[model samples]
Target: MKRSSRKQLQNRRAIWMSIIVLTGMVWSLYKLSASLTLASASLPLTELAVSPGKNHAAPQNGTSRYKILIDPGHGGKDPGAAGASGKQEKAYTLALSKKVFDQLRQDPVFEVVMTRTDDTFVELEGRAQIANELDADAFISIHGNTYKDPDVSGTETFYYADDSFVLAQKVHEQLVKSTGFKDRGVKKEGWKVLRDSKHPAVFLEVGYLTNRNNETDMLSEAHQIRTAQAIANGIKNYFARF
Candidate 1:
């Protein structure tokens, strides 16, 4: 009821009001900062700021290019078919596949990958899985053929999927022309590699090891080189359409 007492009470009230306002503003600022942090963490990796000196440009059309997977059939424990002279199918396939790999690597447009670079045995399904995992544009499986009759001698290519027919045709054409072998032509077959492959795939029975002539030519270094070139050219021709 005293005037001095009323003034002192009003001053205390003013100080408490000021404190309450300041506390609310601090809490509001803290919530805003926490929300901003959460938003930043939720952003996708591609949307994040890249480190300095690093290039993280937006993906350009057609810049990713094509990836090709070359698989040499059989290896290590699996000798595959054997010629009369004891030359194994695994050896020939590896030799030829390496040459093909080298040829494709020389071209900038193609990115080449191999299933097995050495004498290692890769499971049948695993070979196809590799191509699928890498998202290969094409899968070319190199192999040699065998038959009960030695007279069965020729070059043949097989495809399981409709999308692979064109690829098989292109490669088979070059194979027959380059190797000077009888054109067995391209045929459809549900080979594991061809069947399991997500992309276009071809299984090449290059020649019959049972045939004396076919085996001899396949064993030659010169023949292998030319055949590799033919295979690489065939792949290039197939990709040129797209």
Candidate 2:
């Protein structure tokens, strides 16, 4: 072969080799990027599974600082309020109550007990009796409020007689602070559960079940969880002062 022709062929071969090498590098880069993206996608889920509270601090006195008696108001024969979409207030209240119970159970400071865990009727007096018998540190009655006027919306907290005012104020304030809901102010009311219970007790009317918008908000699991956490935080903050 002529030297020039041989040289040209060699140059062509080198060009092809360079093209192959460049293509492989591009493919490797793509694979590495994809792996990195997959790893990032899995990080949040892995972190959540490893230690849920690593992202956010756990409650200060979880399940140990005091005994909290949780009462889910209205079940069985009483179907509380019927929402526009046929959602029952009784069921919603129980669901929220259970969420609150679960959140409180995480803390070491609380020895938590619920008056009823299922869709069964627990009488008003029966609830207070359980708290009294247990000699609980605090009693919280979970409930949803109803109003004929759908416009009447917001959260209201009530204390029996006078002894529970501080707890009522703390919980109500924390709820509003956490949720940005309308503050309906803490007030005094005669409730069988609060009145008969020896422990400091408060009845929480979380929101208006009769209002369609409010009911929708209350029905969300996220909202329920936040409300529960807010109440738990309020309890923690209250005791922190001690």
- Which candidate gets the maximum lDDT versus the true structure? 1
TM-score of each: 0.74, 0.72
Clashing pairs in 1: none
The lDDT of each candidate is 0.88, 0.82
Off by over 4 Å in 2: 1-65
- State candidate 2's TM-score: 0.72
Query: Residue 210, candidate 2: how far off, in angstroms?
Result: 0.7
Which ten residues in a row are the worst by lDDT in model 2? 52-61
Model 1: which ten-residue window has the lowest total lDDT? 51-60
Encode model 1's per-residue lDDT on 1-242: one tens digit a residue.
99999999999999999999999999999999999998887785535443222221111245756788999999989999988678899999999999999999999888899999999999999999999898788899999999899989999999998888888999998999998888898999987888999888999999988899999999999999999999999998887654
Write the residue-wise lDDT of candidate 2 on 86-199 in tens digits.
Answer: 888789878988988889888777778998898999888899999888777778988888877888888899998565777788889888876566889898988777789877
